[model samples]
Target: MSVFVTVLSLSSLATILAALVSLADYHLNDYGVCTININGGTRTVDVNGGSSILSSLAKHKIFIPSACGGKATCGLCKVTMVDTISPVLPTEEPYLTAKEIEGGVRLACQVKVKRDLEILIPGEFLTVSQYQAKVEKITKLTYDIKKFRLRLLDPAQMEFKAGQYVQVDSKLYGAVREEVSRAYSISSAPSDRKAIELVVRLVPGGICTTFLHEHVKVGDKLTLAGPFGEFYLREGADHLIFIAGGSGLAPIRPMILDILKRKLDKKMTFFFGAVSRKDLFYVDYFRDLEARYPNFTYIPALSGAKPEDEWDGEEGLITEVVARNISDPEGKQAYLCGSPGMIDAALGTLREIGIGAEHIYYDKF
Candidate 1:
């Protein structure tokens, strides 16, 4: 019995020692230098080898749009190796389309910079910059939506289009304590240079939304790393129709303000939808804007209004109201922002109203 106890203790100590050694090696091992050629070698980044290419490029301020935070799930961190390439990994196969495979596209978050490599990035990446910022204000926009304003600290400023969105860095909660990022659109006009604002609706279990709603207070430092998406105005568009719901109004507000600031003389009609009066917000803001822009009209549609609530406005689904009102969309362009369902319904209505598919634009929240 004594001999057996001694053997068991020895085994346990050995296992613990092995774990410690393994961890030490992972942390202490030397990763030689690697070079990444960017934009056909128009730019290059020298970074430590053996880390994922996404992390390497991000360190140098080149951001690849990733939806799953830097994890491999979202399959958005796409890259085309411009140097010699390796065979695709099993983890990346499902995400790559056959065309992407033929074109040498691989997941940037998964590929390590094992050797000198060249990569091709979309043109938009050159314009996106990461920001270190301080929270300037956090105001209640509605009962459930709060507005956060971030005054950038480093690079100190940015130039983004009216409808573009940025990903806000988030601290983890529940079982996740690591820092991560989530995307939200800029609500303030681009003319507001010093600070940018975001309207965030509380998602019950959302990592970033929950942090902003519960833990984040008035003054906190943060890092945000994006100016992503291709949803914005199309100048020379014949006429403009805008649709939005809930916090989707964030992106649309900038679009409206952009139009106003630019003195766009185009015909514009804006529709805001809500489940009930409680869900409705920013009606007064829109009303004031409509008064300023004679060609612009603001319509508020309520899908679940109560008669006893003494409401007087267009009622029913936004799409239904749109179908009833707009009879001609032959030369019109539609911009939509809302929940996925509302945008989908609005798209169908545009189709039914004889609008060309090419004339519709949307950014669904």
Candidate 2:
């Protein structure tokens, strides 16, 4: 019995020592540097092993556009890996295609840098730069939506297509102890160089939105990286149809303003949808703009209007209202922004009305 006890103690000590060694290797012991050969040797970054590929590249100022800040939710930081790190993770399964998986495409956020690696990234992303910004003001647009005015402290001027978006970083706050980033469309017109605006609706249980609504202050400084996404007006599109729900108007607002700012002869019709009158915002602004621009039309729709609201505008689902008003959508370009369901319904309606799938652009969150 004494011999058996001594052997058990030895085994337990060996297990503990093994665990300590692994912990040291993972977090304490410094692994030597490794090189990341990017885009077929267009650039190379030497970073220490044991960090995520996304973060390692960022240390070298190579900003890969990630809306979820390496959390694997946005799936924007995908890259074709020419070298092996590990198999595709379950967190990345939903974002990758079968071909992408077979072709060695991996989520940069999920892959750890343990050795040298080769990755392929879009050449255009090399142009993305990080910016420092300050929250100049916050305007409550409705019960749930608020407009944030961010003044660019660095890179004082940003040249982005009106409908593009930027990933805003939320620093540590209540319930969220670590920093995170989420993309928000630019609501401010491109002509406004020094400052940009974002219209955000309170997303229940959303980390970034919670930080913006609860923790962020007017004078708080934040980091933003972007001008990403490709939901912009097609050049020389003569007729445009804009449909937005909730805070989806963030991107559409700037596109409309872009047209008016250029004094372009493009015909514009904007449809804004909400549940009730109280859920609506920016009605006066769009109405005022419509009054000024002869070629622009503003249509606000309420899907669930209260009797006390005395709603006189279009009622019922926005898809139905759109089908009724727009007779021929064949040659028109449609820009949609909303929840996935809203965008899907609008797409089907537009397609039925002869709008080609390619002509309909959307930003789905």
Candidate 3:
């Protein structure tokens, strides 16, 4: 009788939770339609309120760079609201700094547009689009890294700067589970223009990486959105050093290709660091790049090489190789993309090698 009562209580609790979830989905997230005023009434949008301002704009085809896909982990989708908001959500608290809160900046994903709002986002976001695409090819680049070529099926192709990244919406694996979109840097050159390619390294149990590696196949249709990021090359840097590891190579490759194609005569060095020989990829491609440009060099370093590897290049930590290669970092700017630890190490190594904080630029993965 006690077990039966406990079972009944559990069932009742679940039913109540389901009902509340349904209610919130209906009432808190369904403000049929509303309007948004932007830049002092210079622009207006008739959008649905109740979903996050981020998602509502996205539903209408505005692309914001959110690494967490609205879970609010990346803190990329920040918007300034001059008008009132519902309240600060718990999910946004960690990502929000104190000054940001004081300035009326909120995580777009966490804020529901319950009423008409005036918000501030990048102008580039106004141009980003949502596309229906088909996976055309999937080829392994390294043991852990795979290259994916996606062809847009709907409004075919995209116009974007070389260093931007797009968010890939994950499809269900087996059960009827909803998946979040994951962002990755665009690897294909802008010259390709018609198709998109991404370099994805297999992450052990990562939700999106595992799905892309194990379940997705060629010809599978996927919904993707936007070329978003501010990691592109800024003018006036006469000398540039690009550093990357693992899948961080994606954005830097495209940026280099873009610079090369434009016939820009700039001194540049690309340092790619990996763990072993198998971990290294893109050697021949970068070799070709070096042949075409006199002022460019692609240096690949393996930190842990085996006896059979027969390697004689730089050894030890990647930061050590960086410090040895670039003797005078005083005048140059650097771009780093990798794990947070690696970025921190590189930034410290760069500064130790006499690079100013102002001369270093980074996009940490």
Candidate 4:
């Protein structure tokens, strides 16, 4: 009984000390308001110091694409520090390349704002706005993939290019105690300004994806921010080659629709890779488009088709199918979206087939 009492007393003392230290640090590290200079003084925001650049900018309504919230994991919230050169944290080393580091690019989530900062933000990021949206519909596209249709409520409209992406915010649910943000490409066409569609594949332990797939329901309110990424179509290429797999189809779908709606003269060939027929979605949609539009063609390739699949389409890796189909790369530009491994392999294959590196544009998730 005496030993138990003594241990309790010690634990109380430790807790008191920890609280005192936290209080002291809170008071001592209270940096006053600091100014954030953006894009050579194109804009500036004054924010309280001692918070991360990511959260600080977010508080001021400047949204950056961060799939991992502000946890320094996604490495998507990168901003170029123009005047201040800070040490890169160990968490940021794996995401940044030597060239990026040399260019003073730092993960905004990892950088604490203690003083005034001068940074370069992309022109597109300046246009992004937060929105209150309602989950209008949810459609099961595959065993692990679902399509979420979000209708903007607060601001009834969003202007974005066909291939841009948006960041969806998730509430804490079940075992997840922290809110998270994830980036998903908009699958709906730009013509539909009132709503957007996101194609999400359930990652085994993904925080945002799991929340979206399981906890989110139709009519539930959600907060999202948007119109990020530079994966949209570029003009001047008469022949466009699109290659994607899984949820990578999100952005390409809109691009294809936009092109067809505009009645563009460009010839489009889409190569969709999947493990089997079960993994494929929007096949009929693209096939209908192909039948109506002579300039468009849809090719779904199965790399690992099972006997039960009864698949008789193109059988091989996506890269191999692309190589087999395309003989001439002249006046052709390629847009690819998929896993990093698939993108890297496609890059090599496209290069071998005489596609210029400048003509190959990709968005890797």
Candidate 5:
């Protein structure tokens, strides 16, 4: 036989073997199935034993709070390992403390379900379920921010705390092939259980925000889950201070409104910060509330105002304004929502004004 023919035959055989190997790996290398014993076997889920625990649980409609969408960057999907605990991974170290690691806590997004596992999550999470919602209205709040009112289609109504958040799941679009979920604080009063509102600011190059702004329509149906986060107002404080900037106003609005609607005896002062006149929004609504409710006060601040903007309110950074107006924060509870920088600055300012760290609650964007 000729050398060229022999070489050709060998090359063809090699390609065939490679194809057969791939086929076998796809069909025969299955991880089988494993059972997840949850909350002391109060609930058990049998699932394929290869994917991350986050994805596995999600498949069973068991949604864990994940701000970064299972990337393990947010570290919000932590679950206690009841049966067996894996060693702490480096990706999880930044969010976990030594004490947490010692307690067998792990980020569910980072843990692989290779075998039968036992885990523990909060009872509240077990109650959380996915909802079908239709966008009832889309109102522009500011140049970059928009308010979305979603009416619940399934289960008819939702029962979320005023300051809790929901994860909106966006359908695949453009380069995105799989659905994506992003957490946004609910801006509607809890009493309005049939519909929930969210104020979203457009983020440059953000997948979900881009989809929301450009593609979603007023009547579009969307999937969302939750009532997540621990940023709700606690009872018993005599005075309440709400400070927010940009879309951070979401949670604060519902909280303040709930207080006003219930005619709570507690006094509330809301400090809204903006870079200029155009950056501010919801001025009329809050102003109206303030006028009608004697215990409610609305203060809008502009840090950098143009002459044509005709702004007259607190000036300088929001933290500075908060510190200047509020003197004794001894018995006051503060709810702050803003960027990380603003949140940190506000925390420091609150600390300086005799406010205990325990009383200063915040949600950082």
Candidate 6:
């Protein structure tokens, strides 16, 4: 009976100690409130001082472009710190250049808010806002690619450039217990203020992509923030060259439509690359546009055409086709959106064709 009593007493004592320890730890670690001074005190926000700067700013409706959901992988949430809070983390090294580090630029997602901070945010990010949107429709563009049209609910309007992207936040669904956010370029024209379209390709085991591809449905509500990135069309160029592959066509499509709708005095030639006819999308759309617009041309190239595919388009790589078509790169600006490999190869090819590096703009995924 004494032994049983002693065990019970000890267990009760341990439980009390554990609870006290947890309470003490919470009090000790509680930073209470902290202030974030933005852009030299142009704006200030008071937040609870335990979360990341990204989340803290987000709580105040100040959205930073973070594609990896605070994982520090996307490296898009960069802000300049006026005062140093901590040393640069190992995770931020890959994203920061020497100049950026020297200028006190740090990843907002990785920087914890332990105390008051002064940071500089670009003026463009000041206009970014979060919106509650509904998945209005889903269109299958290819086997792995689908277009998601999201209609804004609260704000009902989003003013964004032709090539800017938005970050879609995913919720806990099925096996995906942790929420995530991924960036997708807007495929709709900027004039379409009520809705924005995102073209997403399945990335095997990608967290957001898998959730979007498998679990998301029409009328499903989602939280998204945006109008990020600077991959838009620039004026002053009479001739434009647009190169895209796979889902890269998202931004390019909007730029093309926007330009045509505005009736810009520009000649556009779009070179779309795919593996085969199955990979090609918007062929008829661009073909119809080409037929209607005398200044527009659509060229679809197949790199790995098969016998059964019955392909008779440009039977070569995109770069090869581009080289064969364009004889003069003078007064022309090139816009490319694709994988990093394709961007690098296209850069080399464009440079070889006498296009200056400054005349080329690309958004490499």
Clashes of 4: 0
Off by over 4 Å in 1: 1-32, 72-76, 83-98, 172-175
TM-scores of the candidates in the order shown = 0.84, 0.89, 0.88, 0.91, 0.91, 0.90
* Model 2 alpha-carbon drift over 4 Å, by segment: 1-31
**Candidate 6 error regions (>4 Å):** 1-28
lDDT of 4 by residue, 214-288 (tens): 999999999999888888999889999999999999999999999999999999999999998899999999999
User: In model 1, how large is the Cα lDDT of residue 336?
Assistant: 90
**Candidates by lDDT, descending order:** 4, 6, 5, 2, 1, 3
TM-score of decoy 1: 0.84
lDDT of each: 0.85, 0.89, 0.84, 0.93, 0.89, 0.92
Candidate 1 whole-model C-alpha lDDT, 0 to 1: 0.85
Q: Of the pair 4 and 5, which is ahead by lDDT? A: 4
225-313, model 5: which lDDT tens digit per residue?
A: 99898899898698999999999999999999888888889999999999999999999999999898888989999889889988877
* Residue 300 in model 6: lDDT: 94
Clash count (model 5, backbone only): 0
Clashing pairs for model 4 are none
- Model 5 misplaced stretches (Cα beyond 4 Å): 1-30
Instruction: Give the TM-score (vs. native) of candidate 3.
Output: 0.88
TM-score of 2: 0.89
Q: Which pairs of residues collide in model 6?
A: none
| TM-score pick, better of 1 and 2 | 2
The C-alpha RMSD of each candidate to the native structure, in angstroms, is: 6.3, 5.6, 3.9, 4.9, 6.7, 7.1
